[model samples]
Every structure is written in C-alpha cells, then in structure tokens.
Target: MAGQIPMTRNGVERLKEELHQLKSQDRPNIIQAIAEARAQGDLSENAEYESAKERQGFIEGRIAEIEAKLSNVQIIDPSVLNADGKCVFGATIELEDLDEEKSFTYQIVGEDEADIKANKISISSPLARALIGKEDGDVVEVETPGGQKTYEITNVSYI
Candidate 1:
C-alpha cells in the first residue's frame, strides 16, 4: 500500500519503547490526576478536570497511533543486508564533500528513524535517492534547496 511504512529493527524497538512508556506511565498518571480533579470539582466549572481529560485524550490517541504503526511495521535489520557494496536501505555510508572537502557519515533508514542531528537520513531524501544503487567510490550529485552538490562515496558498510 502507498501508506505502508518500512522500519528498521531499531526503529520498531524505539516505537515499542515509547508505547510502553505511554501505557505504563503516562496513562495511569493521567487517570489518577483525573480522579483527583473530579473529587474537587463541580462538573461544568472544573479547569483541572478539563485539562486532565484533554491530556488523557492526547495520550490515548498516541497509544493508538503507536499500536497501529507496530501492527504494520516491517522490520529490516541493516547489519544483515549485503548488497555487494552498493548503497541501499540500511547502509552506513561515508562521504566526502567535493566542494568542502569534509568527510561525514550517514545511515540511510526509514522515515521514522531519520534524524538529521544524528546523521541518519530518510531513504526518500534527495541525497539518499541519489546515493541508492551507487557503489563505493562513486560520485553522486544531489539537488538540494541550496543547489546541486557533489559527494564522493568513501565507504559503504551494512552495519
């Protein structure tokens, strides 16, 4: 399906962790807060009760969201992937900026696992798209908002 989301093993684990936190921690805490607020309030004029209810609604919504994602997640472990050294999903790649002459590392991952600050880029990103199917030592030119930039693939690893 067009909406099907692919996730790495780590990404799925992270989602499960968040769901666990929301269920075991946030859910009970909010329910207790609501009970406390209800004991001190008249039905229509209780701001504490209203706020607690709103928070409960948000928590329940997120729990449902996480459950849905887990239900449909396809976990792929990058460490076991071997594409004969060609770049693909779950590849850790090292690149040298042709213009800047600076080296950096990035791992191509699913949308949920993509964190620019952590140097994990989404597979759908322009740079990732350009790098896909490319082998080590290949030069790729990616179009960005700043314009086209060239990068040389220095290394590619599955791990």
Candidate 2:
C-alpha cells in the first residue's frame, strides 16, 4: 500500500459517491450486459460481449482504485483548521500578482480536489508549495511553466 492519501471532506464524499455508483449501478449493469451478450451464441465474433467485458474491466479497476484510496484517506476539513494566519493545508489564500497587480483567491487542497478553474490548487503545485508556511503579506515566487511568477499574500483564511 502507498502512503496516506490526503483528502478533504468534500473530496471523500465525492469519491464515495462514485464508488457507490460503480458498485451498485455500473457493475451490475455491465454484468447483465455481458450475460445478455453471451446468450447470443458465438463469443469470438460477439462485439457486444467484448465491449461489455472491456467495460467490466474498467469498472472493476475503478472500484478497486477507489477502495484503496478510501482505505488510506486522511480527510481534512478547512472550516475547522487553525493555522494562525499561515498558509497551510486547507487554507484559502488571497493573492496579488506582483507583476500585473491582479488579485486572485485560491484554496490549497488535495490533488484529487484541485481544480484550477474553481481556484482550488493542489498542495504539490509550485504556487501552493511556495505559499505553504507563508503568512499574509509575504511575497512568494513560483516557477511556473511559462516563467517565474511572483505574488504577494494579501490574506489567509481557514474557511
């Protein structure tokens, strides 16, 4: 088994929902499809059977993956965190681009919950790594793919 998978409360709930859907709905439906396809005679030339089998493999893989992740999950709730104004796991940070002077907000979250469009950054990301342990008004430089980017921490909040 790998190390613990860090996840937020919402991330765990989302994964649990997906696991439920796969086991209760997708798995059963795929089994039924395979059985129905098998009833149609020859197995070698049955495209439906092949497709169903492939889908079954995918579903089973997903189920196992979700199960493993859940088994090793470390859930964190941002609303209850107390970081004393420092950027840490589950901290929502407000930043100002030093180059462009534009303001942005991002929440540091687990990899599974990170969504750039939603302003949830992964803890392992360059910007998040730079922001970690930094207090409000601290300046941080991140090595982005485009180039080096600088930002000032305008605010830090747990929730």
Give Cα distance to truth, residue 139, candidate 2, Å.
0.8
What shift in Å separates residue 120 of candidate 2 from its native position after superposition?
A: 1.4
Q: With candidate 1 superimposed using the best TM-score fit, by how many Å does residue 49's alpha carbon deviate from the native?
A: 2.0
Off by over 4 Å in 2: none
TM-score of 2: 0.94
Q: In candidate 1, what are the lDDT values of residues 1-159, reduced to their tens digit? A: 336678888888899999999999999999999999989969699999999999999999999988988888787776787689999898999999998899999999998899999999999999999999999999999999998899999999987
Global lDDT of each candidate:
0.92, 0.93
Each prediction's Cα RMSD? 1.6, 1.3
Candidate 1 Cα outliers beyond 4 Å, as residue runs? 1-3
True-vs-predicted CA distance for residue 96, candidate 1, Å = 0.8
Top candidate, metric TM-score: 2
- TM-score attained by model 1: 0.92
Q: What TM-score would each prediction reach against the true structure?
A: 0.92, 0.94
lDDT of 2 by residue, 1-159 (tens): 589988888889999999999989999999999999999999999999999999999999999999999999998876787778899988899999999889999999999889999999999999999999999999999999989999999999987
